[model samples]
Target: MPSSTQVQLVRRPRGWPTEEDFRTVSVELGDLAPGQVRVRNEFLSVDPYMRGRMNDGPSYAPPYALGETMTGAAVGRVEESTSDELPVGALVLHGLGWRDVTQADASAFRRVEEIPGGPSSLHLGLFGMPGLTAYAGLTAVAGLREGERVFVSGAAGAVGTAAGQIARLLGARTVIGSAGSAEKVALLTSRYGYDVALNYKEAPIREQLRAAAPEGIDVFFDNVGGDHLEAALDVLNPNGRAAVCGSISAYNDSAPKPGPDNLSRIVTRTLTLRGFLVGQHPDLADEYREAVTRWFAAGELAYDETVVDGVENAVTAFLSMLRGGNTGKMVVRV
Candidate 1:
């Protein structure tokens, strides 16, 4: 038997989740049966989408069970294996996070190749779901064209960082992004290839966006809904397109707030707003991986990782990530 430390959801949070809502435990796992493998997780991902899963509600993915080990994306190395397909020492990615150790059937794990000296956590961040989300939203959903102007909200976070860089790489004439603070705003321009970065905290988002783009934006990558969506609507050019990836602004709201005041802009501007889940675009996985890998290897892409140490602090990382405490991907190094 192997003992593993994990976090479990004790209760559904009414608003912001607290430490009390989760409890850490150590459990003993029985020996792996045939075709089963055990892995020692190196990093566990804490994404914004998981916040919706904490509550019992309708979502693209199921809500977390009240008393089970919480699950999300994780990257680890196989320590013991009963199947030849996943031999010992193989790196793997799976949906068994929130734990330092995970055991499951070999079929549950997908082997990943190591890119020498890179942190394994990369699989849970820019090189993983966040990267794919940005790629698919811009290319497939928004149909971003060469020489178009692009804007991204929540642009200092994981998906936003990836979006700004990808939009530029895809030949956007200009890239604008909005972040919560001056530091993130600077990072967007200094490292992420954004041409204009706005500090939403310094001024009203709409005013800043209006002043920055002056003419209008052709594509909007919306991660923060509420005011950000409203601002994007106001600045979008005729025939503009937007990819609605998330609504983190209202995630912790006790009740639904009113929607964007300028939704009518969709009709006036002839805009196309498409809501998407990255899972819906699995067809683009190989394409995204190849392009991103090439870009990263060639030093064309840059990203930040907000790593919180220890599995016990996973709840802190998750809550922090929700409150925009992370600059990029929030991960727990176990």
Candidate 2:
């Protein structure tokens, strides 16, 4: 038997989650079953979606129970295996969440054989769910076309960073992004090849987005809803498309506030607004990997990871990311 450290939700948070909300404990793990494998968790993913899971409510994803280990995506090295399909020492990715060690049925884990080199955390970001979200949201939902202008809100995040670069690869004439910090803004413009980048924290978000896309936006990759969505709506060209990826701005609020005062603009501008979930377009994952891998290998694309070491700081990392503390994909090295 092996002892594993796991984090569980102590209580449902009222507003922003704090350290007190999570309780870490050591649990004893029994022997693996015939179809199971034991893994020593190496890296845990702390993402924006986990915040919604902490609450006791119905959502697109199921909420975490009060006493159960907090759910998250993680990558680990297999230490013991009872299944013939999985060999010991194989690195696999699974939804094992915040635990330092976990045992799973072989069916629940996916072997990461294609992605090479170290820092397999890229599997959680560029080559994983977030990457697929970036791809599907841009091409399928937003209906992006060559020579069109694209603007992304929350443009320095895991999905946002990928979105801008992917848009450029798809032959977009101009790519603009709005980020929370000056550093993130700089990364968007210089590192990610966004034609224009603005710091929404320094000035009015709508004004900066307006300045960036003066010609009016053809495709708006919306991540932060509320005012940003309204701003995007105001400048949307006729027949423009909007891919609603996330509404992080409103997530912390206990009550739904008046959001995006530009609802009427949707009608007049004839904008096409569609909400998206990455899981809805699972088939796009292969396409995303093929494209991004080529771009990365050719030095045409780049990515950054904001890693917070230890499971103890997972709550801190999550809150920091929501407060725009991260430049790229935020992960936990446990």
Candidate 3:
């Protein structure tokens, strides 16, 4: 028998989650069943959507059960296996994260393909859920067109970074982005493909957005809601489309948060606003993977990860991501 340490949610967070809300527990793993596999996680993902899961209400995904181990995406190597599908030393991707070790039915894991020079941890970032979200939101939800001027809010985060680049690849004439910090604003242009970057903390977003895309924007990829949504609505060109992804701005609010005050513009400008969940659009998964694979191979795309070492620090890494402390994808190295 072996033991593994896992982070369990002991309390449902009210506003912001704290370390006290979680408890680390060591559990003994009895012998595996005939179809079971054991894995040692190499990396685990911490995402903005997890905040919604902390609540006690229903959403696309069920809330994290109190006193149960938290789950997310993880990449790891199978150490022991009783099934032919997964052998010892094979790399895999699974949804049993927030733990250093996992033992489950072999069917619960999927083998990760070798990417030649690319890091395997990317299975938790660029080539995984975040990347798929960006592609589906932009192309399918927003109906982004060629030569369109685009705006992306929260453009320094994982999905934002990918959305900006994907928009450029899809023939966006100009891509503008907004971030909370100066460093992230700089990275939007230097690293990501954004043509113009605005520091939302330094200026009124409406004023900055107007100046950045003076001609008006054709598409908006919204990650931050609240004022960002209102600002985009104010400046969107007639017939503009917006893909409403995550509203990270109000994720931590304990009470009901106000929405964009300028939503009337949607009717006046004949704008199209659509909210989406990646799970709802699995039809685009193969297309997204193929396009992103080509982009990565040709050096047309790049990704970043702000990694926190150790599974004990997963909670801190998650909190840091919520506060915009990470420039790109935030992951915990286990």
Candidate 4:
């Protein structure tokens, strides 16, 4: 028998979640049943979407039921298995995260190619969901074209960093991004290849965006909503497109905030704003992964990760990531 240390939500968070809202529990695992596999996770992913799951409310995905182990994305190896489909020592990716070990029917896990001595955590960030989100947003949703001017809000996190670089690679004439800090602002320009990086905290995002793109933006990749969305709406050129991936700005808000003040621009300028989930766009995953692989192998793509050691620190990583403490993907090294 083996035991797995798992984090469970004891209570629904009121606004900003505290460590008290969760409890770490140790559970004994029985012998593997037929068709089952046990995985010792190498990394646990902490993402912005996890915040929405903490509350019992309507969301794209069902809310996390109280008392169950918190679930997201994790990559690891099959330590033991009864299913021939997943043999021991095989690398796998699954949704049973927040736990150092996971046991489930083999069907719940997806096989990913092994990167020898590579950080398995990359599956949770670049070349995975975050990268796919940027791809679908820019191509399928925003219809980005060559020489178009592009803007990305919250351009420091996993998806943001990917979005900025992808926009440039896709032939955008100018790539502009806004971040919450000076350091992130530097990363956007120096590493992520953004032509203009604005510190949103130092000035109004709409003012900064206007100044950066005096010619108006052709595409908007929005991760932060509220003022960021309003700012995009203010400067989007006619027939511009926006991929509304998230609204981290209002993730913890106790009440619904008002809609973007300049939403009328959508009608007046024929701008397109589409909200999407990466899971809903599997049609693009294969294409995204292929491009990422090629770009990375050719030394054309760049990424970063903020790693917090230990499974016990998963909650800390999640909270810190929500507060913009990480430059890229935030993962717990299990």
Per residue, candidate 3 scores C-alpha lDDT tens digits across 197-255 of 99999989988998888899999999999889989999999999999998998999988
Q: Please give the range of 10 consecutive residues that has the lowest summed lDDT in model 2.
A: 111-120
Residue 196 error, candidate 4, Å: 0.6
RMSD (CA, angstroms), candidate 1: 0.8
Tens digit of per-residue lDDT, candidate 4, span 106-186: 999999996533477889888789989999999988999999999999999999999999999999999999999999999
Candidate 4 achieves a global lDDT of 0.92
Q: Candidate 2 at residue 277, lDDT?
A: 91
In order, candidate lDDTs are 0.94, 0.87, 0.93, 0.92
Q: TM-score of every model?
A: 0.99, 0.97, 0.98, 0.98
Residue 63 C-alpha lDDT in model 1: 98
Q: Indicate the residue-level lDDT of 248 in model 1.
A: 96
Off-target runs (Cα >4 Å) in candidate 1 are none
- Taking every candidate in turn, the Cα RMSD to the unseen true structure, in Å, is 0.8, 1.2, 0.9, 1.1
Please give, for residues 1-334, the per-residue lDDT of candidate 2 as tens digits: 5988888898898888777888889899998889999988778888888888888888899999998788789988889999887899898999996888999799989988646443788888887888888899999999899999999999999999999999999999999899987788888888998999888889888887787777998999988998888888888999999999998987788877976677898899888999989889978877887887888778787889999999877777888988888887998888
Q: Candidate 2: lDDT over CA atoms? A: 0.87
| Tens-digit lDDT string for candidate 1 (1-334) | 6899999999999988899999999999999999999999999999999999999988789999998999999999999999989999999999999999999999999999886446888888888999999999999999999999999999999999999999999999999999998889899999999999999999999899999998899999999999999998988999999999999999999988988888888898899999999999999999999998999999999889999999999999999999899998999999
The count of backbone overlaps in candidate 1 is 0
Name the lDDT value of residue 65 in candidate 2. 90
Local error of candidate 2 at 96, Å?
Answer: 0.5
